[model samples]
Target: MSSKKSDSEKITIVIVGGGIGGLALLNALSTSIDPEKHTVVLVDARPSHMHLISALRLVVSDADDLLNKAVHPYGNHTFRNKFAGNGSFVHGSVTSVKFGDDGKGGELILDNGEIVAYDVLVLATGSSWPRPLGFPTESRSAIEEHIMARRAEFSAAKDILLVGGGSLGLELAGELKDIFPSKPVSIIHRERLLLNDTYPDKYRIAVQKAVEDRGVTVLLGDAITASNSSDVSTSQVPEGGFVTEQGKKLNPDLVVPTWGNRPNTSYLPSDLLSSTGHVKILPTFQLPAYPNVFAFGDIIDWKEQKGAAKAAFFHTPKVAKNVMVYLDLSERASTCDLMASRRSAKYTGCMEMIMITNGKSRGLGYFNILWGIIVGSWLITLLKAKTLMIGRIPSQTGFTPK
Candidate 1:
């Protein structure tokens, strides 16, 4: 097949973006057809998402799953053995895609400056965020450098300013105060609540008390206008939000923006995607517009919540199986439609997300069921640490995590 041709030929499916959903899709692809039955290439727009996911993870599970879902661009042999046993990973971004242009059907215009032919395309590029608000760095070296800088800032500063009041600010302040005990760490939020007022009101109030009890100062409804943009990225528009109706500086030693994540699909066209920014798919998890294409995980804005509590590989086994079935035989659904079961959904955002602070021993978990809540368990913390220390992707496809 050449770069562009307009007719149906032997299906060569090319998956773009190797994040959690992408990897699961690829892993699903691994067992779907024979080794060489379909041509496949997993494309990552960035060099990797390891640091990006890990930093956000500290605020989420802060545990074993981060490394399991991370990607190694340079190609670690052990990591390769663990994850990419059969899949061929290519390092390049899809600059443009031409449909039905190639003899086979379509082809991806990659940044490496090559034409990648495919009959079907699946995109699962997740979103991105910034420091303290999101992952701190892109690579291991950058993270190490950041750790050194933060440690220096920790040692020298009398006051540490936590700029945002979301989970990042809450977790960082609580952990830092716990570690230093006497050092002043103040958390500032532009609004009144710590977490949004959406959950049980008691949840936010209790968390605020817990954070305050840790000796972290909480300042709410205060806006910080920068003295100036001393350092701003050239490509980025004077990107900032604190110069309020009246100018004032709620100067904290640091300012981090954590609320800048949406479904990551800018690389994809607007038509194939739904308003929520995830790819629109039919009930079977196959792209109705493009049946051969399949997607799930963070990219599918389904009835399930994006977090692991709901869409864990264990919960959506049938969605995965259904995709497999549809791929092998046309228009056939799997025996079980687990995706349609929501009455006993048992998976919701209220499901506990075990968020650990920098203090390894201490943690917080948001649980839907009261019985599932626990904190400061050394055994559980130890298990999480071990898994992240060595990257371990879960073998299961999609299930609600218990």
Candidate 2:
């Protein structure tokens, strides 16, 4: 919708769930969406900037003073609002979508029974990955940031077990092993080999060699299921079994759920998606038969990726274009492929950087790009992650982190 319009007739675009994908889309859509012609409603059940996790490659000079939190600890609300700008971050769960004919209009029902009507709906409700907070993106930015720092605390520990030999687990375990060779690292996986679907033998070979060379023990192909039956639906607990199909138990100090995510699609109206709960998208990137409705990021299962794999929120321009097209701005809709972008991400998660802890003198780096499954060093564990951004998100009634 164009910015020029009467306030009363302005079309509303309702976005569900504020994660990497939702927030990124909101950031991109603000300029393109005319506030007069369209109102964007972004909903998530968390305090503003609550679940955005970050690891600073280098600490902000005055972050401690401005955020009122230690440089190593997570910042408070005062910090998050700065990150979100003036974006509308709601802290409420979307119950369901009120389905309508064609793709023109519908209502989104929240758990509070609050009904919101939208000219177009974008299901940017990303998936929930299993982690300490259940959903990796479900905690406050400060809290999750602190968790990354928590890994720093382990730099001096003597022995550690890294489970779930997939990319996440392997990268984390191997990185830690590389960064802290003083500590013995042991990896446990349910499968005989790291998931075959994720990589060819070469990458796995690289990961294995890197980790093993670093004195990390790689336990390949152990089948394990959820130890507890009730945990099957919740995101907090692992499937539970740490045993191989042969019944060998691989124990570790901490086990991270590396991959696997349940999409946030169930929050939409049942009729809005197929039985599987994924919004079926047409080739043009619009939700099947729904014009005002579109999807991107972890929600659309176009590729059979776990939520973690599809968590990149970089594909915002194309999604925004489709929204504009639905508003009658263009004769034809745009496509949501990465190839068209002038600047693009490599789209893989494994970079070799040094890790540091206990005030930066200590360091480790992975010679290989893949997590140090095989040939990593202790330096890989402490410093191989994120660079923080500049900003804070203000406190809002609905923008609470879950």
Candidate 3:
């Protein structure tokens, strides 16, 4: 593909996927650089940006008050009021990217046959989870309905079985128990420990204890396989419970699948992707062969645990600086080894930090790399449960926080 003729002298930066990383990068570039020199365009398939972490909490809760707060439209919120007229939002899905011969610039072909050219490209499409847990939907009402349906299922069920012992599954179990204390809730994890072996032993043990203390049954070290049982009706609450590889049977009225997130990179070239389907980025958050092309958040091949906080607080700032350096070099024609000099220092895999809450009250938090200290329910509630940071989304999108 060849570069298109430009009407203006300004360089164009096209960022795909308006997730946390993309929004942060847009914010950083908009605030740091002069609008006259650069034009920014954000492309996303969804009409609104969904605060997924907060959505998780909302799905399990009985209150419907926070549904509108969890989703924000990009046109009216992120790129509408901000950007100072230098940025535009495209509501479409990119089918593929065609790079220029120089590898510094490219044109993105959207599914709707629209082609957008860019001097620089950023991939922050992130990942997708299963429906009723995490999935892409443009309709806010659809998501609210799904949550309400799931809530009804949870309430009507006599026993609830949550598949996967990861943080999400555990949190769901805790929330279910807290909301419906009389119902029997159990978490079936394949691993022997909660949250797998990635975290420290102390934190795992503490989390297991905290979850079990909430009256949630913790079943570990068993691989669960779902099978249709003749004894259960097709329209039953659970459909059917899973049986362990060890021949253990668990029958619950409701079964919620809550793990595994597939990276969203179908539009990217195969050569630019890792074996696991994630975009391959260097330490500077740039594509290995194409420095002008950057990626971060859950879509990049970073080893750290993926979360909104990690992307917003850590990865986006580094990517912003790298993009700035690239733009500076292009403008000045200087021969500075910007990537070499500004590569992000290797991130030492430190102690894992996470706050898992049952509801608005009980929870568990783990912090401190040197000392694995487990925080009580009150601290977790204070940190996340009370708000789930839903109140911060408006300000995060450049609007006044309500």
Candidate 4:
């Protein structure tokens, strides 16, 4: 990174949402993009990056330091030093983008009434999960308060019911059981299997068995009626608890819904969005109408399931390469040449891969490659069950894990 280039002479690359994808792209650009030619700016609504991968563990466990470990502040000296003279982190929420007629470059209008100009833009404003998994606040203290409140709720509950049997529901059940051994935790999945049909039945069965082995009840093939399910924000069961479609009434002290993650694309234009609210992008991760604008992470309409690992490991490098190529060709290349470069660098898709942890010592998962290899307890514990990859955040952000 160099301080020699004047601001006017450099290309400003603005990225929205400093979640896994945005941070990964920032790290990539920090290492490879020319500092003298390009100035990078990452804007996030939150004060720090909440490692949502380990969120369940943080809230469920009694450990006080886990919350501190789960949050990685963008303004921290370590992160600031990483981007020293080249890039900067902005704290704001984007309300809308004012793109030119050609959709080449645009100014982003922030909710706080600030405008950020960009020569190239990247949207990675990830999805929002249910409570305990999602942070609705922006300030660090408010976020901590939210976590502490959820922790208190879990502590006071006589029994907990996890309302969807996705990865989040399973992981939350596991964490609760691991922390409070006798705390009656149950998972009620609408589907017959633990997960969706993305993986084979064997893997789903293995997950359910692992969860059941931990003494957590696994109720499948039944769903709570809409009348019993509360607002989307809380998704709590009513006073008498919820009655499943199969006529089983569960009266748990706490009900947490783990399904229904909406992409943070409300601020984006409808033209750039799919019917499902995800940004429509070409294989190169660039918007079809706005070539200079790119998107990835859970916010993009990629066929594959969204995960932090996918964004950090796969999408980051591809998007970074394409952005660099676009920058390099902006000065001299013809439209055909630019399109050719983008077409040559592309991400076709990724296979279905998921790992579910059951308590700290047990779990099950499968990778679709090699025809869906089922990973057992030991590998799951070693990989994710114990720490939930909390250390990866610091490493990815150029800091040593404590």
The numbered model that scores best in TM-score is 4
- What is the Å distance of residue 168 in model 3 from its true position? 0.8
Q: Which stretches in model 1 have alpha-carbon errors above 4 Å?
A: 1-11, 47-86, 99-105, 132-158, 174-182, 221-249, 274-276, 303-305, 308-319, 330-358, 370-402
The lDDT values for all models are 0.51, 0.49, 0.74, 0.81
lDDT tens readout by residue for model 4, 1-402: 855779778888998988888888887777777666778788898878878777887887556477777787776443343356667778899999987655457899988899999989999999977887778556989888888888888988998888889888888888888778898998988997988887789888888888888888989999888777663248455777777899998888788888757898999878888899999998999888887899999999988888888988889889999887777667554456547564547898877777788767788878988767998889989998787787787866655535
Candidate 4 regions exceeding 4 Å error are 1-3, 76-82, 231-236, 337-339, 399-402
Report the C-alpha lDDT of model 1 over 231-336, residue by residue, as the tens digit: 2111112344335424543434444443335676665678878887887776655655565555655677565435432333642554556544544553233223
Sort the candidates on lDDT, descending order: 4, 3, 1, 2
In the range 122-157, model 2's lDDT, one tens digit per residue, is: 777776545433422335575547455445545434
Q: Model 3, stretches more than 4 Å misplaced?
A: 1-9, 62-64, 80-82, 226-240, 334-351, 399-402
Could you list the CA RMSD of all candidates, in the order they appear? 7.7, 8.5, 4.3, 2.5
Ranking by TM-score: 4, 3, 1, 2
For residue 388, model 4's alpha carbon misses the true position, in angstroms, by: 1.9
Best by lDDT: 4
Candidate 4 shows a clash count of 0
**Model 2 residue 345 CA deviation in Å:** 19
In model 3, what is the error at residue 209, expressed in angstroms? 1.5
**Clashes per candidate (backbone, < 3 Å):** 21, 61, 0, 0
